[model samples]
Structures are given as C-alpha cells and as structure tokens.
Target: MQKLRRYLALGGLSVGMTVLAACGASPTATTGPAATTAATTAAATARPSTAPAASATIAPAGVTRTASASVTTPAATATRATTPAAATATRAGTVTSGTATRTGSPTALVTPSQAVSNLQRLDNSRQTWAFTGFTVAGLSGNLNPVFEYNGGNQKVTLAAGGTNLEAYQVGGVLYVRAPIGGVIQADASNPLAAPAQTLFATPAALLTALVPANTSYTVAGTETINGLQATRYTASVALTDLGFVNPALAGQGGTAATTVWVDTTQGVLVALQSNITAAGSNTAATARLDVTQIGQTPAIVVPR
Candidate 1:
C-alpha cells in the first residue's frame, strides 16, 4: 500500500506542473490559485533521495502566494513562470515535493481512515473512467502546468469542465486538453498496458505510474464505502528525481504527498488526493481527483 501511494505521488508530481500549464494560465503569472510556491521546509529536512529535490508552495486564498525550503545545492533554484492572470477564481493547491508538515485547515485534519473512505467511494463509483485533473501547491519557482502521454496511435483528449479538467485515454496513450493551449507528452509503453485497458486504462496506468520502481507496498487497513469495506495500502519510497529534465526547477523547495483509495472488492482506484508544500512559506494547495463518469469500452490498441 505504501508503495502504491509513493508511486502515485511521484508520477502525479511529475505531471502536475505540466498539466497546470495546459489550463491556460500565462507563463508569467504567479498569484492565482494554481500558482507554484516554494518547497516545504519539512521535505528538505528528510533524508535526501537519489533523485534531486522537487518542491513548491501553495497559498490559502487560491491567489498569489509563495513558499521556500532550505536545501544545500551547488546550483540555483529553478523557476516555472506563467504570465498574468486574466480573471480570479478559487484555486486549489499545487503539487510539489518536500517533507511533510501540518496545517490547521480542514483538509489537513483528515484522518487516515477518512482518507481511506474517500478513496474507496471513488473507486466503487466508477468502473470505466474518464476525466483528469492536476494541481500543484508548494514550490519556490515558476511552474508550467501541462502534461501529455502517447499510447501508440491512440488519440486522447482532455475536456474543459469549469475549474476541473476531464481526460479520455484511448488505445494505450493518455491525452490532456486544457483551457490553455499547453500540451504535454509522456511515454506509456509498458507491458501491462493490455490488462490495464480492460480495467480502467488511463486511471489504472496513472496509478501504476505513481509507484516508484523496485518498491514494495501492502494493504494497511480497510475502510467502508457506502456499506462496502475497502482495503487501504501504504508504501514508502525515495523517488527518482526528474528535475534534470527541466533544470529551471531545481532547489525550489517543493514536496509531493498523495493518497489513493482502491476498492477492496474490485481492486480499482477510485479517488486520488494530493498536497504540495513550498520550502519556506506556509502556502500550499490540495487537489482531489474523483472518477465522476466512466465511458464504454472502445477498441483497444497496442503500441509497437
């Protein structure tokens, strides 16, 4: 279970920033709800992993905010800058990386059991899934909010739904369509692609991608979802850092923490939640991705 959470956290952090860019925010704006902040001081204090630190900050108002964490590095911090905000809306937290910290917010008070229940409900509610949403909260520099993945020849789409975005994963690839013109591409050519498509292709692959390599996870406990009992797992990992892919993001004091719920009866992920903290500041954002609608099975394809 722990391994599952960690992998989901890592994959989510990696793609969170890129997806945000696809939402249509400019490259220079930093004050909106989705703005990236500094890393959480907590993550910096943890044992260093083989991967470089990936962190950012999120504010409470969903407006301009920044966070930073203390880290010793030879290089400077990377910044993901977006342009000015055109309008104001309630924004959630950004997803970053770093140590864990506690806040007085209601979301922070969520008990481990409650978190599990949320996940179970999400999983039980959807058999076939569609839609995707990404959020980043804590970091120190600028952020680009967009991500894209290719599955052989499958064409995917991310539909705009108010503040939340929807995704459709066909074939073996995933596509993200945002309010903005931004797009992201990732390689999802894995041996498990076929089986995953039968379950919930995009969501399943997404959950699997979040797990770190060579890690172990176990179901820790169970929670009831609408009278049905669901199992929960916890995993721990030191993820491989992808900061080198964009040097501009190093030393930004961001940390990624996420929780996922899988229905014990069916063994499928139903809900995903994440929190990101910036390094120095108290700013952070929390995001939740629930499977609201599922689509009928389509012709499946395998990438060469």
Candidate 2:
C-alpha cells in the first residue's frame, strides 16, 4: 500500500550500488559519446588516435570498444539498485494477498495452516493427560473443572457459580456427590464410550465435537501448564460443534471461542478454556478444563 513504497525503492538502490562497487573498473564505464565521436572522426580523416605513423598506425580497437560498453552498462544498472527493495517488500508482506507488485508494496501474510496441521497430528497421537484452566465469558460466568482420565476411569470436580459437584467413574459404574443430589449412583453413561473412548479423550472429543466450521486456528505460542510445556491454539467455533448429548450441556449450547493447550511432546490436551453464548442469547458462559496430571494420577475411589 501507500506505506511500503519508499522502502522498496531505497532497498533496490542499495543493492545495485553494492554490486557496482564490487566490480572495480570495467572498460564499459570509461567509453562515452565524446570518445566514440572522436574515434569516428579520426577514422573518417584517415587518422588513428594512437599513431605509429599516419598511414601505418592501427586504431586501439580493444580500448575503444571496452570504453563504449562501460558507459552504457551503468545506465542499465540503475534498475539493479531496486532489487534489494523488491526483496524487502516480499519479506514485509504489508499488502493484501493477490495484489500486483508495486514499488513499495507488500504481498501476503503468513498462514497458520502448518500449526493447525500440527494440532491435528497431536489429536491422532492422543494420550493420558491432566489439565486445569479458568474461563470467563458473557453467558457463562466463571466455571472451573479439574479432571483426570486413565483408561476407562474418570474422576472430575466441577464448580459453577456457588454449586459444586464431584464425580468418580470406575469401569461402567459412576458415583456422584453434590449439594443437592447427595450421593448419587449411575450406571453406564461412561465418558469413555462417548466418541473416541480412551486416555486423554478430550483432545479427540473437543476437536471432533467443536472445532469451528470454516475458520482458521491461530497458534498463539507456548506456555507451561502445571510444570508441563504446551503449545496454545485458539479458535472460534459454533455451539453445535460440542455435540452435546447431555441435557445440561446441550441447554447451554451456543458458539464458543476456545483456547486450548496441548503437551508439545505427547500432543495430549493439557488445558482448555472457552467462552460460550446460548442459541438465542448473546450472554456468554465461560468454562475451563485443565489436566495437570499426565499419564499419572492416584486411584479413583467411589464413595460408598
């Protein structure tokens, strides 16, 4: 755009001068119109500029030819100076994509396609992981969950508003303790059976359930989550992507903008945070999941 033009021209000039200065002296530089005219006139008068004798002297053809080349080369070389500027423009990429090249304009921004690909690969190599994250959004205000999954077992604690609930699952049996429900027992409805069904199923489930449709994921950077190194990725996805089978979760359905962290080494989902909005409302709800334990956690015991 208008911002980049001055830079490209200056860059090209700098490049050309450097190339010219390195060449030392070439014959083309010294040859000029005046020297050429003098030689032409001498030939017409039957005289040589370097005379052995008027009739016997040979013109210094080599020197005259070299000088002629040198003079013209420098003019043509004015274009070369702009070469460096062109290179810098490409690097800066300040302009929009698919634009024609101009003196000081840029081309295109770098895409996050590679980072998304890496995240997909991590999903493919899912493993046992534990994470924790605090989330805040307009509809859902401040809900935090810390959970761990080992094979077919699950232990999770959820706190929302002023309500707290804890659940433990061993094989097909699930145990829940809550302020309103006291000690509740449930059979089947196992998380392992929902979707991929394995250790650190979160990465596979979240990716399958709620990756935003027709959107790009941005790799914000890396961070240490609970003493573990993880790569952070963020995306805005529709509410439907969560694939909510649970009545409670389905009721709160809305578009969610999520930020997730995955272990760089194992590619397991280490932490996730999301802001959610309801189907017909603009109010946002926030939720967070952090797996602080990875591949290691104490046994899950059911309360009798």
Which candidate has the top score in TM-score? 2
Model 1, range 1-304, lDDT digits (tens) per residue? 9999999999998787678688876555665433333344345545354233332222332233222223322123322122223111213122111112221122333433444344334411333222222212221232222222222233322223223333335454553334454333223553223322332333333344344334454555556543444444555433233232122334554443655555444444445554544456554544344432323223333233
Please count the clashing residue pairs in each candidate, in the order shown. 98, 27
- Model 2 CA lDDT for position 103: 18
lDDT over C-alpha atoms for residue 202 of model 2: 39
Model 1 CA deviation exceeding 4 Å by range: 1-210, 213-220, 225-228, 234-254, 278-285, 291-304
Q: State how far residue 208 of model 2 sits from its true place (Å).
A: 4.1
Residue range 74-111, candidate 2, lDDT tens digits: 87797787888898888667553334432112101222
